[model samples]
Target: MPKSLHRRLLEKGWSEDEIERTMQMMYSDEKREKHAHFVSATHPVIYWVGLVVAIVGNLLVAVTLIPFLMILNSTQLYVILGIVGFVFGSMFNLIIKDIEHVDQTHHIVAGVFIPAIALITVYIMVSVANRFNEVINNPNPHNAIVLSAVYLITFSAPYFVYKIKDFVWERKQKASEGA
Candidate 1:
């Protein structure tokens, strides 16, 4: 049989009274739920927002690389944005009070998603900048608007994929349960 948590704690030098108190505090239903909600809400919000900012920062770098190589040195701007995003995204782990409660699948999804989005964003931005250098160089209202729309769609693709995966998984789980 697996050792009880309290037993493990005791083996690790936790006093009996301390373990009892900690268990009681941890097992309190209301407190646990509230903590879970706080973690779930804050972790993903910070992570996704940070990811978007980082991707935009990467796109800015890509823009500088292709068409704006001579005209714009936006490396500093992107660096700052990247740093901020990294700090914010890393807070997902820091803000989590209980590691055991974290969904492993979500962590895995983020691990894959962040790098994939970053690479894709850089590629798309560089390709667009190269092809549409004229529009970028001589910016007009219509062209700017169209470019922005394209960027919006490109940046949101990862999120759309995640949602689709989640939807499919949920449907499968429901079907399995029903059967």
Candidate 2:
């Protein structure tokens, strides 16, 4: 059986009258039924892959601190990461919404995955940057604070953007009351 709409309606607390009315309205138009098929829309692989790419590409903060030519100190490099984080966080917020297949689990998955990758990258970053550290004989510091910030700020960004989006949206249901 596909499913029983009547039973489903009863389970959902819809009164008999409401269920009948809703069923009548939904099935009344044969043209509308033809437009919506039962196969379900499946997206291409790349469409799904793009979400991964966007998350990975956006959270590449350690990359800024990894360049050989850019001779800024670790502190300066950390600042650069912050600047990049803001831009990337915003981009991530935008990209996740645009992607069709992404969900809360995807963000939650990234919550763990991005930081794990980030930790490894930061280790590499500190190692690479430490090569230029002649004045202060500092060993490899993982900068856990920065990494935790990466963990929190990166995935939480979309939610913050979503909240702000809510604040900015205006409903046009009613005309101007102030004449």
Candidate 3:
């Protein structure tokens, strides 16, 4: 833990990038200890309540939006659908943040979460777009263009979220194994 050893570790063929990685490892250790402390101090009911709330919120949003998409035959409705996708993705990210520990169980959860979310978002956007085009014989080319761009952005959300999730899970898995 001496300053000279830290400096030597960085200077002796170890680049600044490697030093930063080591620092990050140290930080994660601190974070893990803090999380364990928090979990020990808090009531089990709180964690369960938070988990239930996250699940229920995600479910309600999905269910309500599906029927809403079935009726969308207007540009306004497509816009609304885009907003819904954005908000739902954002909230799911927030919910995942509340999770204090990561493990193989979370690895499975993260693996399944992204594609499912992407599928739902794509389905809703396509459904809305098709319905809107049907209503107006002359489709707005710009609207279609914008919708496509939005859909691409929405598709990427799950990819990034799951990538981070997978990274966290791998780190936790390694740490747990004393690697």
Candidate 4:
């Protein structure tokens, strides 16, 4: 496929800002929707409710899933949690995305907050439930925190990958404009 005009201009060292200005002048009558999130709703309240439900769902999943699986095998418990985290993370990511311009503030906050709370609750529940087990007979917050990190990483991995891609794209656009 042929390179876009913007790409051609950039390759020839035209500043991104100039191309954007020129494009705007050429297509001044066109209207553009600023938000890129895939959610169909236009109201902010719907997104807030989705975010809240996703958080609750994540917590419910983690709270029940971890200890139940921990019984089957203590060694790979964190691994199992991480896998589950990844699934929940992806689902929550979609739920968190919506039509409210962009979740700039919520992205960093809610994105992590949902999974983190779930994992933390899992840690607490596990420690409490395994009070009789020799390994966790003396349950420690430090160990739970460490184990929770495994879940946290996998859960947020999918979401963060998209966020990182956006970040890099933004930086590239900024650098192109600067040049």
- Candidate 4 has what TM-score? 0.59
- Global fold similarity of model 3 (TM-score): 0.39
The segments of candidate 2 whose C-alpha lies over 4 angstroms from its true place after superposition are 1-47, 55-64, 68-70, 100-104, 110-112, 131-158, 163-179
What lDDT tens digits, residue by residue, belong to model 1 across residues 6-35? 889999999989998898898898888989
Model 1 spans with C-alpha error above 4 angstroms = 1-5, 12-18, 33-55, 67-157
RMSD of each: 10.7, 13.2, 12.6, 10.7
| Residue 107, model 2: Cα distance from true site in angstroms | 4.7
Per-candidate count of clashing residue pairs (backbone under 3 Å) = 0, 0, 0, 0
Question: Which residue pairs overlap in candidate 1's backbone?
Answer: none
Q: Which regions in candidate 4 have their CA more than 4 angstroms from the true location?
A: 1-42, 66-70, 99-103, 132-143, 174-179
Tens digit of per-residue lDDT, candidate 3, span 1-179: 55765688866789888888887887787888988888766634554565556456645654565444445554765577567656655655554554435444553474356436555545554556456556765353234445445544653475467668889999999999996
Tens-place lDDT per residue, model 2, 49-153, is 755675467445555555521465546645666556666556655655544244566555644554455555555555555564533554443454564465446
Residues 1-179, model 4: lDDT tens digits: 99999999999999989999988976665433334232434456666777778767866775576456446455567677778878888887676665224656755677667776777776776665565355665432225666677777888788778778879999999999999
Q: Is candidate 1 or candidate 3 better by TM-score?
A: 3
* Comparison by TM-score, 1 against 4, better one: 4
